[model samples]
Target: MRITWWGHATTTIEANGTRLLTDPVLTSRIAHLRRRRGPAPLPEAGECDAVLISHMHADHLHLTSLPLVAPDAALVVPRGAAKLIHADSGPAFSDRCIEVAPGNQVRIGSLDITTVTANHDGRRLPWSGHSGPAVGYRVEGAPSVWFAGDTDLYDELAAEAGPVDLALVPVGGWGPSLGPGHLDAVRAAEAVRRVRAKIAVPVHFGTFWPIGMDWVKPELFLPPGDKFKAAVDPEVRVELLEPGESIEVLA
Candidate 1:
């Protein structure tokens, strides 16, 4: 299996001849955030059989970058989140969306993508009124992959996902404080242990930063990848890739 980290939470999972892209923020900037480390995702990043969106956060559920997916690629998003996008992206755009909550599963060619619960709130906006749980994905194929979209550690996490070969974990965010429902390097390391994954690749860190706050808690930006790697158990292999880099794993 080949996995490419496109900076932040965006990653391309290639296995069993099927490709999946997650939470693609393909542009340099989103809202008040700017890409600080990696280059913009190459065109090949958008070429996927399906697109996995973890939640409704602008960075994870980037509306503008949604069109970058292959024409026929499935857009898998949290339930209720699709409606928020269709209103702005046109009704026709909704045709490609496959909304899911935890425990739901969808087949994409040679892989079976199942949604697992994430402990984050996925509401589109403060007053938007849409509601649904955030989610992660478990891709069952040659090299089983667990894409832990955006979530803090939960008790049933490992039991629900029935993990396989590789795990893509979110170790940090763009801002200084991670707040309530997020994982820092220490917690992310614990999560890797919970999932019992053989290989772990840290994502959602060392990439984007707030527009003018580059000097504030700068360690929260790029050092997370390094920290997560150091925190993980030595028994489990950690493949920490820079944004835009790919690693091939034999599962």
Candidate 2:
């Protein structure tokens, strides 16, 4: 499988003749977070068979960016989150929605995707009703891949060793200090090692930053990926990719 990190949590995975984009934040800026590294994803990045939305946070599920992708691309979102997408992207996009929860499985083209549990809250807004489990995705193809949307390490992280060929784990966030349910560099490394992923790519860091607070702990932005790379087990290969960089993970 070929994976391209499109800054922040957005990524494009091409495998088994199908394309899948995760938490596509295509635009250069969203709200106060601006793209701090690499150029915005090109139009071709929108060419995907499916879009995997890990949760309802604007950073992960930017409603405006939904239309930016191919109209035919199915939006795979957390269960009960389809209404939010419908309200934001309209019925046209909602009609193609495939709502799923942890363990729920769906096939998109040749890819078999299984929704997995995440520790983060998935409410549409901070003030909105916060219920249900946040989610990540385990995509099965020639080489299975794990896309851990935005979560701190879970106790069952290593239940299955080496289950995935490649794991896309979040090492940090756009903010200076991370909150609960978000992994920093060290914790992210442990999570990857626990799963025994043959190859890992650090995401959710070094991409976007706050508009005016570049001076406030700027180390939290780009350094986390390097830290994660340094901390991962030597047995596991770490591919610390910059935004828009692609790597091929062989099965």
Candidate 3:
């Protein structure tokens, strides 16, 4: 299986003759957030068999980026996403969107995706009236990969994920300080141990940042990946990749 980090939570996973994209943030700017590192996601990031959106957060599920996905690509989003993803402002993805709650499974090409719980708020906007449970995806293919979209460490994480060959975990956020419902380097390492993954990749770090804050806590912008790698148990291999970097793994 092959995985490429497209910056932040956006990633491309190629396995079992299928190409899947996760939480794609294709724009160079999203409100106050800007693509401070790595190149903006290219058009090919949208060239996939399916797209998995983890939550309703603008960064994770940009309404504008929805159209980038090939019209035929399956879109797996949280149950309450239709209203937000298909807002009247633009084209509707209602036809391609597959709403799912935790434990629900959907098939797209060679991948069987199972939704799992994530510890984070799933609201799109303060008054958007769209809300749902946050989730992670356990993609079963040639090499099972668990894409834990923005989440904190929860006790049932390992059990919910089942056996994973590669764990794509979030070790940091876009800001200097991560509030509740987020993972830091230490917690991310703990997650690696809990999931019992043979290999792990630290994501959601060194990517986007609040505009004008680049000079602040500069290290926070990109060091978390390495920090998480350093904290992980030696038994598990941690492959830390920069934005647009790729790695190949076997089940």
Candidate 4:
């Protein structure tokens, strides 16, 4: 399988001649957040077979970004998310939206994808009506891969995902200090150990940040990947990719 990190939680996964995109925040800026590192996402990201939305958070489920995807690419969102997106974006995704909850499965070409639970709040807005089960994906093919959308460490982690060739785990957030329901370098390493993945990739870091705060502590953006590499078990190999960078995970 080939994986490309498109900055922040956006990633492209290609396997078995099919392409799957995850949490696509393709534009350079969303609301007040700006892409501080890496180039804007390329047009090729729009040409995928499916798009996986991990949750309802704006960064992950941007209504504006959804239209950029190929008209044929199915939008796999959390259960009940279609209503919110439909209400908020209106007619943006009337045709190709699939709502999935934890343990639900969907097939696209040769890959079989199963939704797994994530330990994060998936609220579309700060006030109310959160989406169901902020989830991750287990993409099964020749070389299976797990794209952990956004999560903190949870007890059922190991059993939920089983085994996979590659794991994409989030290690940081856009802000300087990560709050509850997030995994920093240390906890993400523990997640690596739990999932038993041969190769792990650190994501959700070194991408976007609030305006004006970029220079306050700039080094905070890029170090989570390296920190995760250092803290994970020595047996597990860590592959860190910058935005727009791709790596092949062998079976």
Top candidate on TM-score is: 1
> Can you write out model 4's per-residue Cα lDDT over 91-191, one digit (the tens) per residue?
65845789999899999877899999999987776765755779999998778788899899888899988677788999999977888888999999888
| lDDT for position 104 in model 1 | 97
TM-score of each: 0.97, 0.96, 0.96, 0.96
Candidate 2 at residue 234, lDDT?
Answer: 83
Question: On residues 4-60, what C-alpha lDDT tens digit does candidate 1 reach at each position?
Answer: 999999999888888899999999999889999978999888999989999988889
Distance from true position, residue 76, model 3, in Å? 0.4
Worst 10 residues of 1 by lDDT: 123-132
Clashing pairs in 4: none
> Which parts of model 2 are misplaced by more than 4 Å?
130-132, 160-162
Model 4 TM-score (2 dp): 0.96
Root-mean-square deviation of each candidate, in angstroms? Answer: 1.1, 1.4, 1.3, 1.3
Cα deviation of 5 in candidate 4 (Å)? 0.8
Candidate 1 regions with alpha-carbon error over 4 angstroms: none
lDDT (CA) per prediction: 0.87, 0.87, 0.87, 0.87
User: Hey, what RMSD does candidate 1 come out at?
Assistant: 1.1
Better of 1 and 4 by TM-score: 1
Count of steric clashes across candidates, in order: 0, 0, 0, 0
Tell me the tens digit of each residue's lDDT in model 3 across 1-251: 88999989999999878999999888888889889887787888899988999999888988778777787888888998876666643345776788999999999887889999999998877667889999999998767889999889888998998578899999999887888888899999888888888899899888888888888887887888888878999888888887788998876
